[model samples]
Target: MATQLIELVDGPLDTGKPSKPKFRTVRKDGQIVKLRIVDADSPNFSADLTASFQANIRRARKENREIEDDS
Candidate 1:
């Protein structure tokens, strides 16, 4: 299976004195999935981004299981 990446819609997290991590999602075939959190809050903030990410994760998990079965 090929790796899938869900681009984060959020601009960027605020990484100043008190920095909040930015959020991103990644799906790898044989590697552990990872969330890329950066800093730099952008004006473009979408709630769906987070929601979609959750949904993508659920789907990826199912896909992963199937891949394992194939192996």
Candidate 2:
């Protein structure tokens, strides 16, 4: 299975700081999974999360294609 990076964001907590970007890597298995953010309370939480997820998906796909081409 190909490895993929999943980007995520950590929203500001009660301290009221800005959001911080985060990432995780996982194998690209042919299965869907659920992600649960325990306590995200940012105004742009959904938008930020969606953007990060899509960006990482594109990035992972591109990287995988490059690796395949090299083989």
Candidate 2 wrongly placed segments (more than 4 Å): 1-39
**Per-residue alpha-carbon lDDT of model 1 for 1-71, expressed as tens digits?**
99999878678654333234455567688776657453335443344345445567898999999999999
Clashing residue pairs in candidate 2, if any?
Answer: none
Worst 10 residues of 1 by lDDT: 13-22
Q: Tens-digit lDDT track for model 2 on 1-71?
A: 99999967688434333356554444458655444342367686766666566666988899999999999
TM-scores of the candidates are 0.34, 0.43
- What candidate 1 gets wrong by more than 4 Å, as runs, is 1-45
lDDT of each: 0.58, 0.62
TM-score of 1: 0.34
